[model samples]
Target: MALVTTTEMFKKAYDGGYAIGAFNVNNMEIVQGITEACKEENSPVILQVSKGARSYASHTYLMKLVEAAVMDCPDIPIALHLDHGPDFETCKSCIDGGFTSVMIDASSRPFEENIEITKQVVDYAHKYGVVVEAELGTLAGIEDDVVVSAEDSSYTRPEEVEEFVRRTGCDSLAIAIGTSHGAFKFKPGTKPQLRFDVLRECEKKLPGFPIVLHGASSVPQEYVHMINTYGGAMKDAIGVPEDQLREAARSAVCKINIDSDLRLAMTGSVRKHLVECPADFDPRQYLKPARANIKELVRHKIVNVLGCSGKAL
Candidate 1:
């Protein structure tokens, strides 16, 4: 099957009380691992490319890799999306380059300006049969090119959602409800909580619209311990509690972005593999286990967190 937009998937998720996993893809292993798990679990997924991913692995390479995944995992639906697209140009390029969906992240701009820029991209994307996802409030922490200070971050105002959607015509809306980018989402001794009150208010306003949660990865403690035990220094790398994320998934959240956890899984596995077999220098020797870890992580997410397993064709 061809790549699909998130429209139908989000509709199903909203009605069925589940969310689709929007995993960020950087290389062959990541793409293969994610898609393989989704294929096995019978869950639809979004393989998203960020600006950094496009730079690390060229856009052409990523597209072909996704194409390969599509051919290999033909039973399940897959969507190639541009994550955190900075401007209309990037969104347009993705749409023209065959991505099924694009996100125009203008949340860093002023409210009026964000609406204007998002509307422009939405207009162009809809013309090409591509769906657009736009962000409302800014999220803190680092993710690729996206960075915001904690002082600058703000939760999405529920009141503004209706007007923003009415004006932009975006297929989905990403709202900041305290989920931040990167592994260090919260401090070491603090509780990690999402403002479900804000979320519910937005849902009440935007009723059936698909809501998205960025930086929702639950940084597994096992991966963090593995990385540290294998000679790495990562401190205070806490993420949104899995229980909170599961609650969000059961609500209006249709797409949950998970990048840092995947990075942690791969990094921890590779570090442990190398530590165990110091004499081995082959890339596959380490990458094989890393890939397996990513696959297992994705499967766990599909079944336990997102609740989308067995929902795909």
Candidate 2:
């Protein structure tokens, strides 16, 4: 099948008490690993590209890689999404370039301005049969080009959701409820808790609407340890607890964004492989294990955290 929009996937996830995994993709290996895992688990996926990713690997290259994935994995539905689009031009470019979905992240702007910008993109995207995702609150930490300090980050106001959605006409809303970008989601010795009350209030306001969670990567400690063991020093690299993410999935959250975990898994695997086999100088020798680890990490997420495994079938 060809690429699809997130409308149907979000609807089913909302009804079935699960969330689709929206994994960030930058290169061919990452694309292949994520899609292979989703194909094996029989789960739908969203392959997201960020502005920084587009800069690093040109837009055409990323689009072609996604197209390849679609041809390779024909059984399951896949959506090509632009993650954290900073402006209307970027969103429009993605919509015009054949992205199935695009996110206009204007949360940092004033509420009125955010609505105006998001509405502009939504209007243009709908004409081309593409869906738009909008962000309501700011998230802390760094992810590609998105960066907000902890003090600057705020939880999504449940009261503003109704009017925001009504005015913007966005297909999905991303809310911040303690999940932050990057691996260091929380400080050491502190328990990370998602504000379910805030989430429930938003759900009450927009009962059937699809909700999204950005910066939702659960940075596995095993990968951190692997990286440290192989000449890396990343201290206190923590993430949202898997149990909390699982709870969020059972709620109105239809799409959970995960990038840090994929990075950690791949980086750690490559580090270990190169450390153990110093004689091997081939790129494939190192990247093959990294790709395998990414596949396993995504498979674990599909079955345990997102609970969307076998749903595609």
Candidate 3:
């Protein structure tokens, strides 16, 4: 009926052995596409807003767009989340702005500093009845407001997780287990794999706690081929394996972030349309198909990756 927190969602997912899909949103069409898929599949979803999204589209517009989605699909549970929040103020602002959850990503800082900043956000978010997700290990990827070089990428320290969670008091923890950010997740002739042993260790330490995976998009090759065929160049843009992500979801990973795949799908579809119809001047015609492409991507994630379908009202 209204914005809900990931608290219940993650608990159910953990108990049921399925992860929740948290899709990033930037505009109306993207929001509509993600929610549409969730509604069709009877799944609860997290619509995440990034700092770049807020700067590009304005906070008010994004907030109202989510509100409209709630009105459109009253049967499905949706949570508006602030993804990759840079600091305490940004997390606090989103909590006060009607976001159900916010992520404080201080993973790039020193371990103690990360805990300090995340704890600050947790304290502020709890006051507004909002949930907080914090990152412990730094992940290398190119996302809005989050960019780490591959050379700097490192796995989360297993021993520090218990202390980090205990100190921060965060609702969920995102760990870096060999999954990098962006479309170029892997290079050519290399098999993309996850560090499952590391993940299992984290699960053992924080039993029953909701684990999160950042930059876990299974960059579909079809979309890449489409983009390339339509005058785009994205060489060797490999991502996490869908089967591995499914395995993570069935384990302790309660939330898997997916942004690059959606962008690739939308861009590929739009490019194909424009190339086919060069005389088409109306934006709606191309955007409509792009919206459909994104919606299809969400639906596939729900049924294939996240086993949360039919778990929602």
Candidate 4:
């Protein structure tokens, strides 16, 4: 009915063996497409905003758009969250500005510093009945403000997870097992496989705790082909496989972040549309199909990947 925290949703998902899709939103069409699909699927969803998104569309406009989505879909639960919040000020801003959840990502910092900052955010967010998500290990690839090289990316140490959760009191933890950010997640010859051994070890360390996977987009080849077919140049842009993501969902992973896939779907579809309809000049004429494609992609994720369809109240 209204914006809510991920607490209850994560609890249910942890028990139900499904993950909630946390899709990044930067504009009206992106919000509309994601919510409409979640509405149709009867699934709980998270609409996350990055600092870049807030800067691009302005926080006021994005909040208003999410409010419109809440009005449009009154039956489903939607959590408005800040994705990859870089600092305490940003986290505080989001918490004060009506975000239901905010992630404090200090993974780039040292372990003690990460705990200190995350604890600060957790204390503030809990005071306002908002949830906090924190990151432990660093992820590779570029996405908005988050960028780490392959040499710097590290898998989350299972041994430290229990202590981190205990000290930080974060609602969930985003661990970098193997998933990287951006469209070009992996190199050409490398096999894409998550360190489930690492994941399971983390689970063992923190039983029943909600886990999050960032850079989880699949980078569907269908959309890639469409993009390349229509004069786009994205080479070797592979992502985490969908089946592996589904497997993760059936484990301790309760939230999966998706961004690049939506971008690809929208971009590829609109490119095809413009190429086919060279005479069309209206924004709606092109964005209509793009929005529709996003909706379908999200719906497919709900039904086939995340397995959260019909889980919303």
Cα distance off (Å), candidate 2, residue 259? 0.1
**Which residue runs does candidate 3 get wrong by more than 4 Å?**
none
How accurate locally is residue 33 in candidate 1, as Cα lDDT from 0 to 100? 94
Positional deviation of residue 7's Cα in model 3 after best superposition, in angstroms:
0.5
Error (Å) of candidate 1 at residue 140 is 0.6
Kindly report which residue pairs in candidate 4 clash with one another.
none
**Local distance difference test scores for all models:** 0.95, 0.96, 0.94, 0.96
Clashing pairs for model 2 are none
Query: Could you give me the TM-score of model 1 versus the true structure?
Result: 0.99
- Tell me the tens digit of each residue's lDDT in model 4 across 71-166: 999998999999999999999999999999999999999999999999999999999999999999999999998889999999999999999999
Cα displacement (angstroms), candidate 1, residue 43, comes to 0.5
| Per-residue lDDT of model 2, residues 1-313, tens digit only | 9999999999999999999999999999999999999999999999999999999999999999999999999999999999999999999899889999999999999999999999999999999999999999899999988889999999999999999999999999999899999999999999999999999999999999999999999899999999999999999999999999999999999999999999999999999999899999999999999999999999999999999999885
Give each model a TM-score.
0.99, 0.99, 0.99, 0.99
Query: Per-residue alpha-carbon lDDT of model 3 for 143-187, expressed as tens digits?
Result: 987889988889988899999999999999999998988999988
